[model samples]
Target: MSAAEVTAMPEGRGGRMTRAQIVNAALALGLIGFGLGAWAMDETFLVTLATKVAILAIAGAGLNLVLGFGGLVSFGHAAYFGLGGYASGILAHHALNYTAMFEWPFVFEGTTSMPVIWLTAMAVGALAALVIGALSLRTTGVYFIMITLAFGQMIFYFAISWPAYGGEDGLPIYVRNGFPGLNTLDPVQFFGLVCVVLFAMLGLISMLARSRFGLALQAARQNRQRLMAVGIRPGGVLLVAFVISGAITALAGALYADLNRFVSPSMLSWHLSGELLVFLILGGTGRLFAPLAGAGLYIALEHLLGGVSDHWQFFFGLLLLGVVLFARGGVIGFLAGGKRHG
Candidate 1:
C-alpha cells in the first residue's frame, strides 16, 4: 500500500462525517426530539423517564472515564453516587426543617439551592475519590476492583446503620430543590434543566478526552512504563482523572436524588455499580456517547418491556448476552460499522 492510501484510511469509511460522528449526531438529536415531543404532548411520565436517562448517562460517563480511558475497573463507584445523593438529601433536609447542619466552625447551615447542592456533591465525591484512588490505584487488575468494591460496601453499610439519615428507610426531600429563575416544580422545566447539565458535562468530558492530561492518562493506561519514561507521572494523571470522574458521577447522583425527591442507601449498592458498568458495555466503551447510548437503551427497554412482562429483566438479560457475545463494540460500534480500539 502507498503512504497516501494508508494516511487516507478515514476517508474510505466516511465522506464529510465519520460513521461514529454521524451516529453521535443522530443520538443527540433523537434524545432532544424525544424530550421535546414528550413535553409537547404533556407526557409527564415519559419526560421523567427521559430525565432519568440523562442523569444515569452522566453517571455512566463518569465510570467510562475510569474504566475505559484510564483502564481502571472500579467496582465501588456507587460510593460516590450515593454520597452525592446524600449530599442533596441531607442539605435539603436541614434547610427545609430550619435546622443548622453544624453550629460550630462558622455556623454552617444547609441549603435548598440546587447549585449549592451540586457544588457540595462534587466536592464530597472528589474527596472520597481522592482517598479511594490513592489506595486503590496502588494495586492493579482485580485487586484494584476488589478494593473499590470493599470501600463501597463499607459506605453502604454505614448509610444503613446511620439512623439520623433515616437508616435503611432512606431520606426524602418532600419537595424538589429550587433553581434560579425557574419553577423547578414543573416537569418540563426540570427536564430542561437536567438536559442542560447533561450536555454541558458531555462537552467537558469530550474536552478532557482530547486534552494533554487525557492523552497522558490514556498513555498510562496503554503503557505505564513508556508514560513514565517520557517524564510524566502516571500516578498524578490517573489520580486527577479518578477525582474528576467521581465528581461528575456525584453531580449525576445529586440530580437523580432531586428528580426522585429522595435519597437512599440503594444508591450505594453494588448492584447500582454493576448497572453503570452495564451501560458502558451496552453502548461501547471509550466513546464519547457510550454512556448516554447505553443508558438510553437500558431505560427504553425497561420501560417498554416492563409493560409486557413482570419478568422483563429475563428478556433484557438475553439481549445483553447477545451484545456481549456478538457485538463487542456495543450498540454504537455496531451501528457505526466498526469496532473501536483503545
Candidate 2:
C-alpha cells in the first residue's frame, strides 16, 4: 500500500462506519422509541423490560472492553458487578434506616442520592479492578483466567459471610434512591436516566477503541513482543483497561440493583459472569455494538422461552451453541456481512 493509502485508513478499522455501527445505532434508537411508545400506551411493564435490557447491555459493554478489545478473558467480572450492587444497597440501606455508615476521623454518612451512590460504586469497583489486575496480569492464558476467577470467588464468599449485610439472604433498598430532579418512581423517567448512561458508555467505548491507547492494547493482544519492542508496556495498558472495564460494569450493577430494589449473592455469582460473556459472544466479539445487540436478544429469548417452558435455559444453550458453531460473528456479524476483526 502507498503512503497515502495507509494514511487514508483510520485507526482500528476504517474511518467510515461499519455495518455493525449502523445496525447498533438503529437498534438503540428503536429501544428509545419502544420505551416512549410503551409509556404512552400505559404499559409500564414494557418500559421496565426495556430498562432492564439497557442496564444489562451496559454491563455487557463493560466486559467487552476487556475481553474483546484488551484480549483478556476474565471469568470473574461478577466481583465488580456485585460490589457495585452492594455499594449502592449498603448505602441506601443505612440512609433509609437513618444510620451512619461509619464514624471514623470524620463521620461517614449514608446517602440516598443516585449520583453519590454511583460515584461510590464506580470508585470501589475501579479499586477492586486495580488490585485484581495487578496480580492477575502477572500471568497469561488459562492461568490469568483462573486467577481472575479466584479473586471473584474470594469476594463472593466474603459477601456471603458478612453478617452485617444480611449474609447469604442479601440486602434490600426500600426505595430506588433519588436522582437530581426527576421523579424516579415514574417508570419512564427512570428509564430515560438509564438510557442516557447506557448511550454515554457506548460512545465512550467507541472513542476509546479508536484512540492511541486502544490501538496499543489491541496490538499487545495480537503481539505482545512486538508491542514491547515498540517501547510500550503491555501490562500497563492492560491494567488500565481492566480498571476502566470494572468501573463501567460496576456502574451498571448499581443501576440494576436500584431498578430491582434488591441486591443478592446471585449478582456476584459465576453464572452472571458467564452470562455476560455469552452476551458478547452472541452479539459478536470485538464489535462496538455487540454487547447491546447480544443483551437485547438474550433478554428477549429469556422472556419468550421462559413463559413457554420451565427448562428455558436448555433451549437457550442450544441457541448459544448454534451461534458459536455456525455464526462466527454472532448475530451482528451475520447481519453485518463480515467477521469482527475489523
**Model 1 spans with C-alpha error above 4 angstroms:** 1-15, 339-342
TM-score of each: 0.94, 0.94
- lDDT over C-alpha atoms for residue 272 of model 1: 94
Which residue segments of model 2 deviate by more than 4 Å?
Answer: 1-18, 339-342
Question: What lDDT tens digits, residue by residue, belong to model 1 across residues 52-113?
Answer: 99999999989888877888898999999999999999999999888889988766679989
Give per-residue CA lDDT, model 2, range 1-342, as digits (tens). Answer: 111111234543656665655677688898899899999999999899999999989889899888888889999899999999999999999889888889887676789899999999999999999999999999999999899899999999999999999889999988898999998889999999999999999888877777788888777777899999999999999999999999999999999999999999889988899989999999887777788889889998999999999899999999999999999688877887674342
Q: What lDDT score is found at residue 296 in candidate 1?
A: 97
What is residue 336's positional error in candidate 2, in angstroms?
Answer: 1.0
